[model samples]
Target: MTYKYQLIFLGDINNNACNTIKVRFFDKIHSIGLRDNMFEIIYNETFERKYSNKQPSFVFYFGNLNHSEKDIDILKVLLDNGDAILPIYFGDNFEAEVPKIIHVMNGRQYIADHIEKYINYAFESMRLLRENRKLFISYRRTDSSAVANQLFDAFVRNNYDVFLDTYSINPAKNFQEELHHRMTDCDVLIQLYTNDFKNSKWCNEEIISANQKQIGVVEIIWPDCTPDIHNLLCEPIQLTQKMFMNEDFHNGSCCITEECIENIVNAVESVRARNLAARQDNLVGEFVEEARKQGRQLIQEYRYLVETLKDDIIRLFIPAIGIPQSYDCFDSLRFRKLLDNEKIELFLIYDDLRIRKKWVEHLEWLNESLEVKTIKKKDFELWLKNN
Candidate 1:
């Protein structure tokens, strides 16, 4: 996807030079289907004001020997800070040689192609930098402003680029749009819940938005109240008003306090840690399931191979015996133990050779035993006849 980027062009190009650069950029942007709004161009004259206004994704400087030393120094500062600098020298001069500067030929296509590549690189770098430092805090003003202010101050003190509606964005503007943009750009959202918090549509909407965005939400509870908060949050941090007023809030310590402010900070940190752990666990579980499936498939294939070998062994060996006679080896005591273990008092069977031989002894034993008072065995046909 093509992302919007602010491009600031520096250097002292004359009227002809300016026209040439503008036409070149316009043609390139049009060719690539990019609108004028996608990029911004600034000269050295309006550099400071524009730079202070908005953060740019990429910077291009086109300078030559005719430029003043002060302008060269300013460009050097930008270059030293790792801003992408593209210089278009009027004539061949080795004096302004710098490893950071990319020499561009005075052609539309060449400038367009090089600028596009540089812009992409700059964008990717910005993305990585932004992903590393992102934090968002969500709180209801009706619940506790003091706690919210303290939390915002703590984050600011810690050098975190915190996005809390209380202080981050301009309150005078369209708040809903601003809030949506801030929440979407944030990596984590800290939610402070009070007794009356669930009743507010704005708070509920913020929570839902954070959840939908897959941003981490840490729910902090107000002191001395349990107002159906569980329905809104799976894991909420319980705290009280006294806990928030303590010195722990100032030091950025998450000591599991009952105060709302301390609890909020602690809960936010805990949720962040938990989210990281869950992501790792999910990755590990996926790998384990894949390995298990592979193992099961291997086992199935091995079993098939073994059965095939067994059939081959049987076919090669069984034919030599012509017709095999089946033999029965009975263990009376083991069979009796099995029956006793199963809690079965009697077993019925046909009048076989072994049954006939042991019939008198078995009857005598049963007559003397309390557990088994009788024993009977009959053929399937004979049992039907008797019934």
Candidate 2:
């Protein structure tokens, strides 16, 4: 998962402070289960301006009174923008310089004694925020009951919130309705395919339902039989009951070995992640299409209003079109080329109010070279109101 927070480590490399923070702090953070690539270390002050448009979640600065004015300015800006600041002052001179608005925490002391606590707290917070685990176990009870039970028990032991019809469905409830409900909500379906799996009507229905909902399916092949690839929900993971037995596991066991369980867990998690990403991409595509439709409608409405205002002398500023996009994305580059050297105002209408520093750089280039106007949706509305 992509972390929403951006952690910045600003310090002097000459004194090896940055190295200590990287090795002693951030590495341990990742090892202790926080997401990787969630932060960056910046030793140079010149590049700090690159973050002027987007605020970081937290800033850690290790320096004394001799730190550059540029670094101080960056820290001040970060603190002012509601970001947390951890300042490590080598001497007493800079202690008084820390802003009152930001809670001043000694970075060196925290790294030495309380880094693990802080890191673990952060990890727990992130886990709670991203807790969306819905697993469905699809198995042919008549053929693979033993292995299926073992897999289900293993997953429960690992604290996963999963759905197994044997465990999840109540005797009083309508079985088919409850089963469909569980399958619809599942993020990933783990299919335990035995020799007679395809012959089972219920198993085929489950697979078809999962496929129709666009949920991910992970097949655990217990039999020598291969499922028809064209009809299968997703790629099948071939695993035999003998493979588990080869590792000193027996038929009577209630659960599989830890290694086997870990492998299954990793596979399920990987497919679950893919399912989430695919859904998000589909949502973004849908949003872009709807935005384009609305933007064109608004343009047509405004154009008609302009024509009505000036009957014969209606001199529109060329025939520029506005595109709904993020500041960094200019997918209409070829379309823009079609209006080359036109007097019309080419407005890049952004989706949101917040703009990134990288986007500001892109916009600056567009303004100087292409003469395109970069405006937010709110600003465009304001222009329409005033005009």
Candidate 3:
């Protein structure tokens, strides 16, 4: 079976910090409600067996290795295979602890309190979270307007490109259409789940649309309201009176405390990785399903997934969550360079749902001379039928 994500730990197996990191890693995963299929954590003991079956997607080397030559060979193989390895040290001396092979790459000095950052970067390295972060604030106006405004400010302060309907939508634009369009480009939906959230037609559809697009959701639920059942994989953060700055929740206002906002942001970061993987899976599955309808044999490989054809040609489809950027093309070019200079066609598979027409035209213009083209979700079936 093709796993969506894989993380492996190597080096200092007996370190207390490693144990601490492992415990918290699983806790973080559970806390965020990451789907079981989203990732698997392979330990040192089972490394060989697991590595034999499936290669590691990301590796955290705990540092200062006195490991056997055989294990070193395995690490070398991982490097040769282009797997991402992060050397983590605790003794302040990276060269003293990490082997010379990893010397060329930058190593991180492990901090006791920075496990969250480590895990977050691991996801980024795996292409689960794009470097540019953007989110949509989904809430019922009458129920969470105040809280929504507070979060918008907080997210903006944190350098996020957050989308709030009231502030984002222009004066003359088609409200519903523009709302839907902006949502297509957001990485996650921060839902302020109040008592009357479901009562609002637009609010209801925002959450539903987020799920349909396979975007992550961080639901901050009110004390009296039960968490919405739409996102089965998200463990909602239940709110209490203590979390409110005003110490009172009203029909149209909830000013959550600073601490609560921080927790919510962390929760969103955690969910972001898994949701990106899920979206890629959705896009790849849809494309492959379309291809199979016409009896085209496709195999899954590469960053998102790749397939080889009968004409000695390789097609690499990298899922472009939100918007496909210049970096996506550059990264794909880097990956392409790692392989033989074989006949290859690179593509960025994405959803065109509500994406701005101007950006779409820009992408089309970029495709004329650019070697890496794009395939939109809306055109998947037709793309297959014609291609």
On TM-score, the leading prediction is 3
**Candidate 1 residue spans exceeding 4 A from truth:** 1-131, 227-234, 246-266, 274-387
lDDT of 2 by residue, 156-191 (tens): 654456788888888997777767766665667887
lDDT per residue for candidate 1 within 1-387, as digits (tens), equals 112334556554563554555666567555533346545466677766554222323454454455524365555555333333444444456235322323321112234345544443333322222233357777666555556667776655433468777667775766776676566555457666665565678667766666554456666666555646534543566664456544332222322333444445444544543443232223222322343444411011100100012232210000000001111112222333522333323221211211223443554455475332322222222322332
Report the alpha-carbon TM-score of model 1 versus the true structure: 0.34
For each candidate in turn, the TM-score is 0.34, 0.46, 0.61
Report every candidate's CA lDDT.
0.43, 0.49, 0.70
Judging by lDDT, tell me the better candidate of 1 and 3. Answer: 3
lDDT (C-alpha) at residue 241 in model 1: 40
| Model 2 regions more than 4 Å off | 1-131, 246-257, 296-387
Kindly indicate the candidate among 1 and 2 with the higher TM-score.
2
Model 3 pairs whose backbones collide: 64-97
Give the candidate order by descending lDDT.
Answer: 3, 2, 1
For residue 121, model 3's alpha carbon misses the true position, in angstroms, by: 10
